[model samples]
Target: MPSRKPSASLLDSSQDDPSPEDALALAEQAEAEAEEAEAVAAAARARARAIRLRNQAAARELLAGNDTEAETSSAESTVTEQAEPTETAGAEDADEAEEKEEEATARRRRLHIPRLFWKVLASCLAIIAICALLGASGFMIWKHGQADHRRQLTAEFTAAARQSVVTLMSLDFNHVQDDVKNILDNSTGDFKKDFEAQQNDFIKLAQQSKVVTESTVNAAAVDTMSDDNAVVLIAATTRVTNTAGAQQQPRSWRVAVSLTREGGQIKLAKVEFVP
Candidate 1:
């Protein structure tokens, strides 16, 4: 009794089938692979959700920035429009005030200038008239003073000339020394020198001739006058009584006498007979 031989299909199936331990290991490995695949899918989904949230947040921030910029621009434009009209109105008001002030100043100047000018003119005229009056009064005083001074000079010169002529011509033989001394005292310069040189001869002649003379100055006038010197023209008469005359004889004479100031006294400098 031989057992029946196994079919080929069955034998192959049995050889291909794993053992229980191998099947269990294979099933465990498959389960582990499935679990690992599920974990990888979950990681991928989490990364995609995070990326979408970040993209949405970025879009919201961009929209907010753009809205803020638009609002700022609109506000700036409104402020510029309002400020421009206000500044223009203020400038027009300033110009109107300045023009009104200038017109008022011009009207005040026109109203007051003529009165001020006439007052200044009258003051100047009064000053000028006062100066003219003072000047005329001073001139008149100076003129009168000068006339008085000239008259005093003429009188002094005339008196000196008359006295000099009288002293020169009057002589007496009885008082010959006194007569010569008087002549010398009243004279100076060339007359004194020349008369002194011929004094002895004149004295001798006067004594020998027994002369007595008397003189009178009829008139004396100053011809040319200065501060310290003067020339005078004199009309004089001399009465002579000598040995050859029975009575006194009168002689008319014209003399030009030059006078000088000597030691505060006027003296005769020179004398010339006028023919």
Candidate 2:
């Protein structure tokens, strides 16, 4: 038998089949191309991101500049508005203070006193001082006059007491009745009643004894005095004589006599002997 002739399809298939080494080379080349394409795409994306970041930075800078300008304008306008009002208020306060000072000065000038008015005030003060001095002098003179009058009254009382005490001690038996009568006349009140009641006995005793007494008042003083009454103290010495003639030693006597104004005369109301 003769070998069959190969068909066109088989011939073509066998020719198209690659060798192992060629297939390996083709796979390596394809992988290299794919890696290069991927690298190109990554580079494109990186460029786009860089462009976006730059634009954002520029936009923020522009916005910040605009805000700063607006704020500066507004602050300048506010400062200008406030400055005008503050300056005007300061000027007005200064004017008002100056006007008040001027008014106070004018008021002081209006209330000023005149020289003549001061002179008249001084004259009135001098006159008042003179009047006060004269009044003081007059009061002193009146006080002295009152003292003199009291002294005169004391002397008068003392004289009356001395005279009355002397009268009482001087008694003679022969003139007993007359002496008793004189005693009764000089006295009033309890003294007069007591002596009158005992007068009869006193007269009888003197006549029987032939008694005679002469009295001398040594000293007299007004102890107490009022408008209508006075008390007087008297120191007296008496000489007594009987049938024996006269006593060698005179008897000393102290008496207190109370006198009252009766019928415009100072008369003894009571008498007491003092030890």
Candidate 3:
């Protein structure tokens, strides 16, 4: 029997089927392409990562440089600020020193004095000193003269007091008018007026009573004395001859006398007996 003719469909199917070797070759080619594609993709990723890292490094370096520049600028500004006051203070000190030097120079320049004016001023001062000394000497002399005058006045007052006391206390009845007149001459003020008014009566009483009196001053002292007034304490003893008998008595008296000087003579202004 002859082999049956293969079917057309079977023939076509057999022609369409690949051999195993060819299939293996095709699979190997596909694997090679896939590996190449994967390698290319990995290279692209690596390049991107390296570029990113480089960019980041550059950015960090830029920031660091900026920070360093900023710090350096800040330091420079601080140094400038610190130096400014020192420079200003030095300038001010220099100006002050120059001003003080100028003032000293001006003072030295202004120190000139004229010799003539200085001599004149000194002469005037010496004249004034001499005048003052002369005036003081004159005043001292005047004081001494016044003291001598006061002593003279005191002596005169003491003599007058003794004389007046002796004249007043001693009285004689036979010469009553003369005795009263003598008392009137030595006495002044109220004592003079009162004695003058009672003169006639005193004379009559003395003539009738036949009274005779003699007084002697024992001691007298001036208590207070001034230029115009004096107080004197006088102690005396009196002998009285009356119709009954003759008696001697001791008496104490105080007298205030006021004097006025007129035409270089001291006259009594007031006289009083103090109890």
- By the lDDT metric, which is better: model 1 or model 3? 1
lDDT for 63 (candidate 2): 38
TM-score of each: 0.59, 0.56, 0.49
Model 2 per-residue lDDT tens digits across residues 1-275: 12234345434655778678866766776677677767877887778557545544443453345556665455434433533455435434644676698899987776665556788899999999999999999999999998887787787777778878887889999999999998999899988999999999999998998988989999888899876788999999998988776575799999998888788777778889999
C-alpha local distance difference test of each model? 0.80, 0.76, 0.68
**lDDT tens digits by residue: candidate 1, 117-181:** 99999999999999999999999999999999999888888999999999899988888878888
**Candidate achieving the largest TM-score:** 1
Q: Which number leads on lDDT? A: 1
Superposition error at 233 for model 3 (Å): 4.4
Off by over 4 Å in 1: 1-108, 243-245
List the candidates ranked by TM-score, beginning with the highest.
Answer: 1, 2, 3
List candidate 3 stretches off by more than 4 Å: 1-118, 218-233, 243-245, 259-271
Q: Candidates sorted by lDDT, descending order?
A: 1, 2, 3
Worst 10 residues of 2 by lDDT: 1-10
Report the alpha-carbon TM-score of model 2 versus the true structure.
0.56
